[model samples]
Target: MPVPGFADRWRIEPVGAMRVPGVVFASAALLPQVAEEEALRQVANVATLPGIVEASFAMPDVHWGYGFPIGGVAATDVEDGGIVSPGGVGFDISCGVRLLAAPVTLGEVGAALRRLMDRLGVTIPRGLGSGGVWHLPDAGALRKVLEGGARAAAQAGLGTEADLRRCEDGGVLVGADAAQVGERALARGLHQVGSLGSGNHFLEVQVVEKVDDPTTAAAFGLSASQVCVMIHCGSRGLGHQICSDHVRLMRDAMARYAITVPDAQLACVPVRSPEGRSYLAAMAAAANYGRANRQALTVTTRAAFAEALGTSAGSLQLVYDVSHNLAKLEHHDIGGSERLLCVHRKGATRALPPGHPDLPDDLRPFGQPVLVPGSMGTASYVLTGVVPGEAFASACHGAGRTMSRHAALRHVRGAELCRRLEASGIAVRASSLRGLAEEAPEAYKDIYEVVATCERAGLARRVARLRPIGVVKG
Candidate 1:
């Protein structure tokens, strides 16, 4: 079938055996960038895959990526010989966002904001190969984290049980076979559990400035005067190594299975194949490690806040934790029939609507909390999921990068950007000046616009808006 026409900025065409047509959402303002990017081509390639049920979709933030676009979504029928692509999961497996609410208000911390920022900068390690506060775990302990996620951390007395309830999949993925993980992957992950890895990763202290949906905001434990912390990281080198190892394995398997794709990066095998099952198991293990990593960071962050503010750690509570880069087994209604499918979300968040069974009991009435982190020195948003939307109940993960690190460094000056952010009341800390320039606010799209689009498109509804008070980046 020919793609339904819309605007000149986007062109979509159906491929063989696609149950649904492909959709590309872009604007005239972004046409040149989209045209030059490989993301659109990847979208077409994804549509050619076996068992792809609905449309292969790309958001306005779409950019060139390994196999699918950075902002891509695809759902495959698991029972119909569907395939799982390592490229779909990306290198940073379970790379996600975690948000925390503080008992104190912004006014209470205003006078000490600078001091706190400095103290946090000194306490937290950031940058390449930065070691964390946790001792490296042995193989046995590492397996526990790979299988138990934040629940394991809670059992170790790192966080409260409530934290697990607020995290997606309760901070764990079932069927994780740690035995399938390599020794090197285990070693790299053990010590890096609580560390914030470099490249667009950060921890920010923010103040809730606006509440768009009062009922939903209340359900999420967020209020206009409340302060929150957002952490963005992944499974570190462990996840990267898993992806690398499987991509090579899958490339060979693809050829052996007589599968051909437009891009080598899109290498994949049938979901029922031996190689596919193994990759899923290892991926789940790495994803669990990522949840535990965030939980560990939360423990450290709570301690830091308590000591700095002369309060108790119990005063800090988890709001939500969501994974953006992942593939999950879910049931979604299609053509009036409910069927199980594997949904691949790369740079996209799972936004389950209100009353969704997967949500915690307390939060089910409001909907799933979606954390959309902006680039450094900008505002981030807290949104709630809604039903009957495009892209299989998913939304953009962040204010997607509009420029590359190299491009940003060439065009932006680090010192000048720092001064500008400081002038706006945001304290900035970094290990490298060049790194700072690479994550400059100008390097990303306007987050407000992105969130607004999500709302208008019915993917998610805005609950609260937050502006940065302090930022620590790697």
Candidate 2:
């Protein structure tokens, strides 16, 4: 039911073994669709996780997922025997979005848009089984990437200090134990360190079509008509294998720990347990790899822009890079006391408010920049965290999927979609038309509505709106 005074908020009062109630952030228009899915039930199931603090929260873009709903956020008290679940983090660990601000404006790139798109299409390595821009020579090299993340890439001259400063966690996820990463996971990551894997992953060239908050937009280094690059992907096979390996291990170890979850998919173990510690270590490694993957893509994008527009790679400045998946141990005030909690965000972006110590020195006054990618050839948004953020300072990741890829394929043809996008002045380059069809704009919830609902819910404030001019799909 809707929260009494909050139009965008709904609360599912505990009815079963739930330790907390379930809170869903969504507008009246989006609520019906969200409720029709199994996501609401998953939200309830998540509330039952041991030691979970506050309510099990779902973002406005909630959708059905493996265990916890894709747009789920939950924090558990560590000292109170909190548990960590692989399902809570999802398979694509650290799968996130990064935005790069270009020196040129849309007008400046006129007539050269196609050329730029063409250069990026061939240069940006994407799609499943495609080798990345940077290939590790051996397991040792892969280990370095898993440990150092984008910092490792920067050390190799593939990135810069400025780039690291803009990344979450300074580009490297701490507590990563490369030794915990299995051989199979390592093998999968070796040749795919800098690539965008398939299924909704993309490299998009966009222009700031509207500045909702001019002051905030300027602080984020964005202006109307300015060009930008948004890259969306994840840790790829390496992250997948890590999540799979850890889920199996946790499932087997759950019985011994006496942990019982409503669903087998929600298998978890105590935060201090051996299995839990091991999974966090491996998850961190995969998170680092995901960061490194995006960093490498950033390098590739810079080169493509330089070659196509006769500009220097330095012309592009990273606005920010944030992940929507994975879990982290954070300190939050609870009942008048600060406690360490394991915060799990699956398909949700962390939105640190203004004046947050975690923000970069220059961006602290403006708040953390939250990148929200829309479906192919649609409008995306740049949001900033607000004070008193709900759901543990988390917000929606993207315009959440409404139809399954299979359903999307049934409604749209790849070739036809490509023609339509091109006719609408958006350049489209995709490895597979079938894959392209799966990401049709109609297949997603309205991006505008999701962000607006987020704002009403006080999760984040919109800074700018972006319109995609070109896209390279995996």
- What TM-score fits each model? 0.95, 0.99
Which segments of model 1 are wrong by more than 4 Å? 1-11, 15-20, 27-33
Error of 2 at 185 (Å): 0.5
- TM-score, cand. 1 vs. native: 0.95
Best model number under TM-score: 2
What RMSD does each model have against the real structure? 2.3, 0.9
User: lDDT of model 2 at residue 130?
Assistant: 83
Tens-place lDDT per residue, model 1, 391-416, is 78898899887788889998899999
Q: State the lDDT at 13 in candidate 2.
A: 98
lDDT of 1: 0.84
